[model samples]
Target: MQVDYEVIIVGGGPVGMMLAAELALARVRVCVLERLMETTPYSRALTLHPRTLEILDMRGLKAKLLDRGKPITTGHFAALDTRLDFSVLDSSSNYTLIIPQHETEKVVEEWAKSLGVEIRREEEVVAVHQDQHGVEVVAVGPNGNAVLTALYVVGADGAASIVRKQAGIPFIGKNSTFTAMQGDVVLKNPPESGVPSYFNEQGLVMIVPLPKGMHRVVLIDPERMAVPKEEPVSLEELRASLLRILGDDLGISDPFWMTRFGNATLQAQRYREGRIFLAGDAAHIHFPAGGQGMNVGLQEAINLGWKLAAQLKGWAPDWLLDSYHTERFPINTALLTNTQVQSLLFGSSEFSPSVIALRNMLSNLLQIPEANYRLATQISAFNVQYEPDREMEPHVLNGRRFTELHLRLENDVCQNAYELFHSGSFLLLHLGSDERLYDVIDWSKYKHVHVVRASLAKGAPDWHDVHTALIRPDGYVAWAISQSESNPMEAIRKGIIHWCGHV
Candidate 1:
């Protein structure tokens, strides 16, 4: 049978599902193909950064995710028995959120389904062809061969992406040199105190807290010392190794899932190829260091989703579609580099005495207020900022990470600034004492933008405490003029146009 959609997304993992949801919410017809018949039971990624939380909050899934996961207020970096808690970071989001990747995917899938997106499970995409008009995808489903045609194609299909391959895009990078095994196991004496811990030895032994008193562990050790290659890794053998390293106190019991992976860092040379584009792991793969793999992928989906929708809706300028590659490619490349750095710290055991001492010193330094805050910002991913130099003067906040704030509008009532951003339109926030900037914006001509005003009766003015800010449809700050601005909108406009184009 033949089907048609505004976009056909390959891969139904978290990233793919997120793209599906975004497309459906934009009222764009979408079809997502998944090779798996059911969701994976493994807790692949359990840490959700504050930035990712903010993204989910936009979809109204934050509360539910928090309910399903535990909040880790502290993280400790240790050497065998000695440890240093890096949780004292003076930052807005001081903790790591531990929500299983599967649960996260469930929420996104439900949201996509609610938007009436078609999800085809057990359907394997075999080939992709893009012509001048659109893209044609062939897949094998349960009954027989099926074809799906769409104006655009998005590959969120993980590290080995069929769409990217069929589109002749190059995935450039090195395969993982470090070998590690990850699994969810029952520990006899799991820590019941603050945040879980990482017991770094020759290789890393991490214990990450999961909901319902469960925990996930990733053990990275020398390949030779690891158990012999076997179809199903012997739980008893893994338990023995744990006893040898982390000690017998763990009392490892039932293991829900066990898998081994090597540290392979790879990224697509280009994210967009003609009418087909790549997002998430389909575009890049890196070490699961700092819990950034999943979060980075999610951000890619968010970055691409709105742009694709805008282009399909005929609201985006010609160059806007290509901007997806320009903005995100470098970002993903940086993430890959960061992941590689983290692996060296946690995955390798060839630490000289000097190196060990240096690590300890760095750990202590990270405890300092400024260092902790910086680390927190890096790990939590709240430091993402877009270029702010391209839009018109008096531009609404553009090309930056969106900030959360509470505001009292012209009406006596007050509400959260993000609430106003639900429309996914370009917002023109007129801060107090800066209402005159509104004159520069042609609100009547731009139906896609919203103009509003706000004063402090609601919250403070830190970046996280921004009282009034304009958010782009993709949940980024288009331009933010402080209530005490000295006509700073012009400067902000310079940055906004860099991303929003000349619109």
Candidate 2:
């Protein structure tokens, strides 16, 4: 069985392209098969949460993204009046970047192409067959039918994934309960004030400003809740919904794009089957509450890409590849749960008095700093914590994202911690005066790990007490130790072997 590529990714959305770029960064041969000949014009998702921005920063894409989108310091939870204050988050990028999904795809596509990823557009995957050695993918394109073989195949296609269906993976979840409409339209008489959100006895409506003069309007009309998804969304329908929700229609016209969606929530029973795996909408779908769909998919790609590349590269631990599902499934489950709750909170055509009281109570609670911070962290994904391997006693910082800190390298250059991860490799940062820490490990053996001896700058109180730490490529602290550790060298060796594998 000769493999044409190390990996073949079905669908060239943000997740697929992100994984492809990551594999390419590791010099793995990868290709993306997409059914669409070009990028989508419609912007389905319009915001990148805080954690997502931090991930992009690790790869040096954050600046470019910031240039294209506006950064809003505050976000909302279930459209509540109390704002989730992103500015209070403990990361360099603590704000949500309001960039369109289309622009996001374009940026990731360009980055993937630059990394030598072979993206074959207009190629639709029809059938997938896998054996112990490799997986064979049958795709139909403009030219004809072709079979491509790869060591591994990942399905990033949307909800109606052909790869997932052909693989016989059960997508277990509920169907749409209520339907809603969304449109990007030019408003002749736009509301002169804040983002308008109305929830009453009739339905829910929200109007947000877009990049151009267009406004994005979302409406859930109980009367039209039974509207079939296949039916086209007309300007008149949007206008009528607006009039019903608001006193006036706001003069919406010349719609750029319009579509209908539902609150159907689903998650794949498993993320991987043999050599074929799932990601993005192929793995899970829920109501677009909190604007988390694309962000979660992108984060999933980040989690899977490095592990898959490590397996192909032959340095991966036996449990490394499987940990992808072990680590991400719980997060996806939580995401589904929260979105379902939000659907119940906002998807209704009318809010009962009890529901209004609940909303008011919850909003008041969010006004409390701790309560707001907790929910904000969850929504922004800043609170994601993976379980550390039980081989050693866990440090509090272990399995958590390494807080961004400034470091003064031996060469006297000062930089933030994220700059060290731009190369997508493990960083062994020694934050003490003991240069002997560098001699504890033989550098020649671990080619993917870089060792840096530096001292913490003046104001990193979170990391000031930490003498040494090993940070993973994904920007999480694999292991850390305070100044009081008895056997620092031995502990460091154990941590390295546990995380990076042995020489």
Candidate 3:
């Protein structure tokens, strides 16, 4: 059998599903293929970042997800009963919502299906080829072999992606020497308060609370490690290990699922190869430290989805495709580097008494302003900033973040500044001191564009203090002007011309 679409995503995981949802919402036909018939029950990422929560909120999915996962309000760095509370930063996002990966997958799949996406399960791609015009993919389904041709192909498969391999993109980086055992187990006595605890002993042990009286536990060792198996983990062995490691802290009894795994870190040299591309685990993989794996993958899907829509609609330039690599590859590289450094810190041995003392001291010192700032930089996604090719206008709002301001329309509907971002249309917001600035823009000239009056006094400072700001469909501030009486139309015109590639 043969089929064709605007874009074909090569994995049905959370990232791929979300991408499909985005594309479908944008009226782009897409297909998603998966090797597994169903979602796995494992709890890979027990924590979701705040930025990710906000992103999902934009799609109206965050409230439902908040109900599924227990929020981890506080965190601790402990060793041998000595503990340091890092909950100060927890105020930013009181919880790292602990929901199973399967639940997340189901939510995304349901949402994507409602948006009209074609998802094919039990399909494995055997071969992939790409040319200037499009990509041809061959996969083996249950009934028979099937072929798909599409303008764009995305590989969200996994760390060992067949599509990535077929694309010949070099997977670079080193695998760690140490291994760890991780599993979701039901305990006899679960903690009343939901908070993640880290134990730094002979090896690192982490306890994360899950829904329905289960705890996602991890035990790590440098010399001895448990081997991975396809079947369910042994309940008896897990109980014994917990008894020895955790002692009386949290009683361990019933086991739901367990898995043993080694550590490895690798990144793709290029995310795009002609018409073939990679996202999520296919593009990058690293140690599961900091719980950044899934979050990074989901963000990649969101970033690429809209860009693909633009290109398919004939509004994006040729170089727009290359921007995916330019913007994401650096972020992936930084994440891998930070995770490696953190692993070294968390994986310290007791033999190094000096190192252990220094670590504890540093952990305590992390409560200070400077140390807190450094840790916050890693924990929060605010540290990431993409550098565009051309220089930004020299102004205060130039290259700064887009704030979520409140806007009131003539119809008396009060909403967020982002409402102007709907329909992937460019929005020019006039918040200048003089209302005359609004008269400058002839709204009738642009049919697809949105113009809004944003008053700072109405709500919190969502965007920076700029008189006039032009926002891209992807929610980026393309051009901004400070309070200026000078004819601002020239700046707006230049911004539109530059971003739309009309010049």
lDDT of 3 by residue, 167-200 (tens): 9999999865555677677666766654444454
Give the range where candidate 3 is weakest over 10 consecutive residues by summed lDDT: 75-84
TM-scores for all candidates: the values are 0.88, 0.97, 0.88
lDDT tens digits, residues 1-503, model 1?
23488899999999999999888877788999998998897767887877787777766777888887777664333322233223553333346677888988998899889889999999999999998889999999898999889999999999889999999998999965656776687877877754444444444567766666666766755543344323455577567556655665377778888877666889999999899999998999887777788888888788888888888777676777887888888777777777776666664545355655667777778657676666566666666766663543443444657666666777857876666655556666655545555555454555667677766554453553233455777677665555455556665454344444455
Q: Taking the candidates one at a time, how many backbone clashes does each contain?
A: 17, 0, 3
Best by TM-score: 2
Q: What clash pairs does model 3 have?
A: 403-462, 403-463, 404-462
lDDT of 2 by residue, 262-299 (tens): 88899999999999999999999999988899999999
Look at candidate 3 and tell me the lDDT of residue 496.
54
Among all candidates shown, the one with the greatest lDDT:
2
**Candidate 2 error regions (>4 Å):** none
Would you list the rank order by TM-score, best first? Answer: 2, 3, 1
- Candidate 2 similarity to native, TM-score: 0.97
| Between candidates 2 and 3, the TM-score winner | 2
